[model samples]
Target: MAYVGAATALGLFAPRAWAQEGAPAAAGAVDGDPKAFGPERHGLSAFGELQYPADFPHFDYVNPAAPKGGTFSQVPPNRSLNQSFTTFNTLNAYILKGDGAQGMDLVFDTLMARADDEPDALYGLIAKSVAVSGDGLAYRFRLRPEARFHDGSRLTADDVKWSLETLKARGHPLIAQSIHDLERVDIESEDVVTLRLSPKRTRDLPLTLAALPIFSKAYYSAKPFDASTLEPPLGSGPYKVGRFEQGRFIEFERVADYWAKDLAVNVGRSNFDRQRFEFFRDRDVGFEAFKARAYLFREEFTSRTWATGYDFPGVRENKVVRETLPDLTPSGGQGWFFNLRRKKFQDPKIREALNLAFDFEWMNRNLMFGAYKRTVSVFQGAPEMMAMGAAQGPELALLEPFRDKLPDSVFGEPPVPPVSDGSGQDRNLLRQAQRLLREAGYAPKDGRAVNAAGEPLTIEFLEFDPGLDPHVSKFIAGLKIIGVEASIRMVDAAQYQQRMNAFDYDVVSQRMSMSSTPGEGLRQVYSSESAAVQGSQNLSGIAYPAVDAMVEAILSAKSREELNVACRALDRVLRSLNFWVPAWYKDSHTLAYWDAFSHPAQKPRYTRGAPEFWWWDAEKADKAGVKA
Candidate 1:
C-alpha cells in the first residue's frame, strides 16, 4: 500500500527494493561534502550514496524480459487491519473517513520510486531528476516532459505543488502531520518544482516528499477531495481503474500507453495485465476459497493454519506450491501496547510486571505450532540498528546525558521480555512479577491486585481480529493468575481503528513496520509531542524526553555510522521503558499459490513483489487445472 509517512500505524509496506545494476557516479560528481548538493540525479539515498546511477537499465530483482498478459488475483497480506479490507467506500486512500480499497496505491504514481535492495534510496518516477540545495533546506525536482495523467493531460510542477498543498491541508491526520515541517512548495517553472523545508527537519525529508503520490489537481477541482466516494480519481500510474463491485472486488488494468512503462525503476514490474483483489470477511473462508481456486495466491499468517491446514488435495496433487521466502529487512515492532495516558499503567514497575507476566514460550509452542521467534527490540532482527549486549561505545556516549532520566538498565544489557518454561504457568516468573507489583504500591487484596485506593487492577485487551482471541485469551488467563482482572474485548476493524485513533482503550494490539533508515517517523511513535495528537502513531503514549532526544539524534545523523549509533541508542531506551509486551515474528514469508505463475529466479531481499513481478503461465494453469 502507499503509506502516508515513515511511521505507518497500520498498512505500511517495507522500503522499496534497491537497484543494484548500475555503478555509482564518478568521484567528482558528489562526495563526502554535506554542504555541497549534487547536480540533478536519478535517485537519492538517505545517508549514503545511491546504488544505481542515472543511466541504469533496470532493478536487479526484476526480469526485464518477463511476459505480462495474465490476470493475478489474491488476498492482501494479513499484517494489519488496513491491509485486510472487507469493503471499500472510497477510492481516496489518503482520507480517514472510510476504509479504502486495497491496492489503490497501484492507481497513482509517486514522484520517486523506492529501491527494495537498499536501506533508504529513491529513484525518480514522475520526476526525471531531483536536486537538493547545499544547505539541505531546498529541494528541486524536474518533472519528466513525457509524464501524463491517465486522462492524457500533461503533468507539470503545478500538479505537484497542488498535491503537496492539498494533502497537507485536507488529507488524513497522519498525512497532515507528516508534512507539517514542509514549509512550502514553490513552482519554479512549468516543469521544475522546489520544496522548502522547515529548519527543524531531517535529511530524509526530501526523500519522503519523493514518495508522495501525486494527484491531478483538475480532477479534485470539480470533485470533493475529502469525501469518501466510490468515484475513481484520475491517476498516471501504469494501472488504471478497471472494474469493481464496490467492496467485493476491484480490478486494475495495465495501461498500454503508460508514460513511464520503460523507466529503469519499472521495466520488469506491473507484469499482470489485469490485477484484482478479492475480499473475504473471514480468514478461514478466504483459505477455503484459495483451496477452490477462487484466488491465485495466498500468504499464510497463522502458524497453525500453515502447519496443519495445508494437507489438502491441491497440494497433494502437486497443483499448488508452498514456499518460504526469507525476509532480510528489520522485523518491526509488534506487541500489546499499553496506553501510558492511563494513570494505572504509568508506574514503571507495573509495566515491567505486565511484561514479565505474559508467557510467550507457552503461546508459541502450544498455539503457534512452534513457528515464531520472540521480538527483542524495536529494531528486532536488524543487526546494525538493534542494541545488543549492552549500551557501549557511541551508543553509550549518546545515552550518557540522559542517564539521570533513564533506568540503570539502559546502561547495562538491553532488557528483553521474560522467558518462561513451556508449561504455560511459570510460577517462578509469577512470583517475581508479584514482587514488582508490590513494590509499585499494588498489594494482593482478597487474591486480587489492588492499588493504594483499594481499587482492583483491571486490564482490557482490545483486539480487532477475531482470529486473535485464542492467542489473546491465553495472555489474559496468565494475567488472571497474577491477581489481575484482564479480559479480551473484540471489535470489528472499523471500531478498532476508531478506538485506537481516539486512544480509548487500555491496551491494544499494534504492529508498526520500521524502515531500514529510520527518520522523522520515529517521532510520531516515541516523541512527546505526538502523545496527545489523535490518530498519531504514539500507540504506547510514550512521552519520555530521553526517547525524544534519541529521535532527534537519529534525525540529525550525518553519516551512516552516526545513524546506526543513534538508532541503537533509541532502541535501547525504548526497550528499557518496557512500554510494550513484545510479540513474535517469522523471519520468512509463507506463501502458497497455484503453479501457474512464474517469477524471476531471484526475489528482492526486502519485498515480496507478488503480482507486480510474477507473470501468469497459461500452460501451467492448464496443466494444473486452475482457471485464471
Candidate 2:
C-alpha cells in the first residue's frame, strides 16, 4: 500500500499540534557564518547525496518517450479502513470532516516530488531549487517562473506561504502535527519562500515541508478553508478535476499545456490522458467489474482469489495479463495491535501470552495457500533497517542507557513470534500461553480465564472488512482454546473510523507503512506524546520513555550508519514489548491488468508505476477486444 497522506492519517479534526520543546540550536548564523551552506540546489536527500544530479534529463525508472493520450481506469487502491474512502464528499482533501476523493493529490503539486528509485530523495517540482541554513533550522525554496495554476495565474511565494499557514491552522490533525514546529514563513521575493523551523525539530523538517501539497490562496478567498466542499480548488499540477458523480466516479483530465510536462522530474509521469476511479462497496464487486472490463486495471489482494479465481475467459484468451511485482520498500508493520490504554492489556505477561497463541504456520499453510511469510520485525521488509538475531555493535550501545527500563531479552536476541507445528492446535505453545496467563493473574474458572474479581478475560476484535471474517475467526478460535472469551465485532466503515479515532476498540488489525528512509513519522506512531492524542497513529497506546528516546535518536540521526543503528535499537525494544501479535506479509504485489496497457521494460525499484508511468496502446487494445 502507498504511504497515506497527512490528511488521511488523522481520521478527524481534533485541532491538536505536537509540542516543540527540546534542545537548543547546535551552532552557526545566517550571513556572517563561514560554515553556512551554499545557494539553492535542485534536490534533497535524507542522509546522503542524491542519485540524479541537477540538469538530468529524466529519472532512470521512466521511459522518457512514453506516449500519453489514452484513458486509464481502475478501482481506487485501498490501504486501510480510514485511509480509503468509499464515497468522497469533498474535493478538498486537506480538511478533516469529509471523506476526500482518491487521486485528489494529483490536482496539486508539492515543492518536491519523491524519487521512486531512491529511498528518501526528493527532486524539485514546483520549486526550481532549495537551500538549507547552516544551523539546519531554515529552508528556502525558489519557485519555477513558469509554474501556473489551472486558472492560468502564476504561482508565487505568497501563495506558498499562505498554503502552509492555512494547512497548519485548518487542515487535518496529522497535517497540523507534522508542521507544528513552523516558526514562520518568510517571503524574500515574489518567487522565493523561506520556512524557519523550531530548534527542536529533526533534519527531516525541511523535506516534510517541501512535500506539502501547495494550494491556491486566491481561489479560496470566497470559500471557507476548513469546511468540506465538492467544489474543485485551483491547483498547479499535471491534471485538473474533470467529470464526476457525487460518489460513484471521479475523473481527472491531463493538462495539455502543463508547465512541468518537460521537466526532468516529470518527463514520463502522469501519462494517462484521463484517470478515473470507479467506486464499489466491496472488493468482490470491484473484481467482477474488472473481469467485465469495467476498468482497465485491478490489483488483487486476496490470496485465495489470486490463486483460484483467475480462470475466466479473459485470462484463457490472453486478453488479461497477471504479474507478480516485487516490492522493494519496507512493508512496515501489520498486526493485531492491543490497546495499551485498556487496563486488561497493561500486563506485559498477558500481552506476551496473547502473542504466543497466534498459529501463523497453520494459517499460512491452510488459509493463505502458503503465500505468506511470518513478519518478524517492525521493519521486516527492509533488511538494512530491520533488527536481526541479536542487538550488538552500535545498536547495543544505543540501548545501553535504557537497559534498566527495557526487557533483558532485548539485549540478547530479538523475539520472533511463536511458530506452530502446522497443526491448528499447537499444544506446546498453548500450554506456554496458559502458564503465562496464569502467572499474570488469569486462572481457569468455568472453562474460561478469569481474573481475581471473577471477570472473564474477553477480547473483542474490531474489523471493517467482512472479508477478514474467516482470517480473524481462526485467531479467535485459538484464543478460545486458551480459555479466553474472544469475539469479532465487524462494523461499517464510518463507525470503524469513529471507533478508531476515539481508540475505543480493545484490538484492531492495522497496517502501518514505513518509508525506506524513516524519519519523524516514527514519532507519530510510537511516541509517548502521541499516545493520548485523539487521532494520532499510536494505536497501541505505547508510552515508554525508552521508545520515545529511540524515536528521537532516529529523527536526529546525521548519517546512514547512525540511522540504521537507531532503527535497529527501536525495533528490538518494540519486539520485546509484545504490544502486537505479528501478522503475515507478501513480498510481491499481485496485479491483474488488461493487455491494452503497457509499461517500461524496467519497473521502479520502490513502487508499482501503474497508470502513472504506464501508457495505453491503441493497437494492443484493439487486438485484445478491449474497448478503450
lDDT of each: 0.79, 0.79
Which residue pairs does candidate 2 place in steric collision?
Answer: none
Tens digit of per-residue lDDT, candidate 2, span 1-628: 1111122232111111111222122122447672464466788777546789788999998988888888899877653223444567677777656667888878999888888787777888999987766666677788998989988999999889999999889876667777788889999999899888888876666777788889888988888988878888788899999999977899999999998899999998899889999887676777788889888887776787788889999999999999988877677787889999999999999999898788988888878788888888878787888887778888888899999988898998788888889798899999999999999999988889999999999999997666667777988898998899999997866677678778999998876766766776777778898898776788999999999999888877777677788999999899999999888787777889888888988888877788778988888989898766
lDDT for 477 (candidate 2): 90
Worst 10 residues of 1 by lDDT: 18-27
Model 1, span 70-122: residue lDDT tens: 88998766323233345565677787667777777888899999877777788
Lowest lDDT 10-residue stretch of candidate 2: 10-19
- Count the clashes in each prediction: 8, 0
